[model samples]
Target: MTLQQWCFSYRGRLSRRDFWIWQGVWLVAMVMLFTLAGNNWLDTQMAAFCVVCLLWPASAVMVKRLHDRNKKGWWALLVILAWMLLAGNWTMFNGTWQWALGRFVPTLIFVMMLLDLGVFTGTAGENRFGSEARPVNYFGKPNYQ
Candidate 1:
């Protein structure tokens, strides 16, 4: 699939390897943004802009990744919701109700989702999402067989 379709549409399956690579791309982009913008309102604004622009792509990727596991794409929404709810508040819990409401619960959910998306292998062969994503060998070349 094209990069636009792979990262910005939710119409197909994505293998774990592809999903992992996509995450890596975003990680590098985030590091670059942070390093370039540094500690300032510009940094925050830039981050927000990046997130807004990438949100659809991020959702599309997660949906496709979930499809590779034979699950509904809407599950991606739950993950996004969890992040939206918990990603604020830099201060780690300090004996406030926010500890339970923000830190603890979201951490548990995040760990679970991480395992679900990043650890487990996708279902083999065709599924409801689509035909299996074309498999790539160790060198990232397509395996013809």
Candidate 2:
């Protein structure tokens, strides 16, 4: 997808290929943000802004990823709630081990969930979430019967 389309496109389900492409883009953006900002107050602020900017696309990707697993996108909302709790500790209160634990533990769980979703192929044929993501094609063209 084009950059603008990637930014704006949130409807329908995303295939595993789409999710990986978005992830690669996100990783590149993050690396650039860190390399440009370095260890400075500006870096801190920019990091926060970057996170805000990425939140929607990230959420959309996660939702679609879950959809690929035949789960409702609402489950991603719970992931957000967990993230808020984690971020709150870092932002509102001084960084504490408790806060780190709060963030890291739940995040580990979430990562595991993502691994499960990505590693296992979805059900063949249409599901409640959407049509089965075109047959693992590299180009993402739907293989018609």
Candidate 3:
């Protein structure tokens, strides 16, 4: 798939390599934006912009990666759920252990998702998603089988 389609649309399988590359690029862009914008209102605005502009592409990448794993796109929502849990700042219990539990649970989910999506190989060939993941050269050209 083309770069535009890869980032904007969500209808294909993506190899782990492409998922890693695109995710790394997106993270770098987010870090640069936040760093350059500084810790002020502009930073908040930039963060908002990143949410609106950058987040969807990241989601698309993850969705495609999930597809490659022969999983439903809904699996990608785990990342968001983990993030939300981590940010929840649970105070349900007065005990400090509650915080630890909350953090640990989400962190565990994150680790599991990371391993499933990044470490494990995708389904050997297309199962239900689409064609096999075409290997790409350094310059992004398809390396046909």
Candidate 4:
């Protein structure tokens, strides 16, 4: 799939193959950014920005991951809102314990969500979210067939 198509196809299922491919792309991009940016402070900041840009695809992959488990993409909205609240609190308080709490708690929640995604398998056959991601063989039957 094209990167844009893969990123936007949140309504359907994702195969493990697709998920790993996107993750590899994310990791390679991040490594290249860090290696090329070097030690310059300005370059480091620019690389941070580039990392955020690269995270779009990663986030999209995560969304599809959630979808594979039959969860709604709206779950990502909660994650984003929690992050925004934490960031806002941190900015207002300037790194106090309260700020740390604001940031840390949401991060914990987000991490838990990711852990849940990792362990949960999608429903077999067609779920409300989409078709089974397991591939069909050349005989035009499911591999399990």
Best model number under lDDT: 3
Tell me how far the alpha carbon of residue 7 in candidate 4 is from the true structure, in angstroms, after superposition.
3.5
lDDT of 4 by residue, 55-132 (tens): 666677677767777777767676776777666645445566665668777788777875656556666777777777
Give lDDT: candidate 4, residue 2.
45
TM for candidate 4 is 0.64
Give the CA lDDT, 0 to 100, for residue 115 in model 2.
78
- Which sections of candidate 4 miss by over 4 Å? 1-4, 40-49, 89-100, 134-145
Candidate models: Cα lDDT each: 0.76, 0.68, 0.80, 0.67
How do the residues 1-145 of candidate 3 rate in per-residue lDDT, one tens digit apiece? 7677778878888889988898788788877777767756356776777767887888888888888899999987888788888777678776676666678778888899889889999998667988887543445676464
Per-residue alpha-carbon lDDT of candidate 2 for residues 69-105, written as tens digits (9 for 90 to 100): 7787777777766666666545544567666657776
TM-score per candidate, chains pooled: 0.78, 0.67, 0.84, 0.64
Q: Give candidate 1's whole-model lDDT.
A: 0.76
- Of 1 and 4, the candidate ahead on TM-score is 1
- In candidate 1, list every pair of residues with a backbone clash: none
Q: Please give the distance, in angstroms, between residue 24's alpha carbon in candidate 1 and its true position after superposition.
A: 0.5
Q: How much does candidate 3 score in TM-score? A: 0.84
lDDT for model 2: 0.68
Please state the error at residue 32 of candidate 2 in Å: 0.8
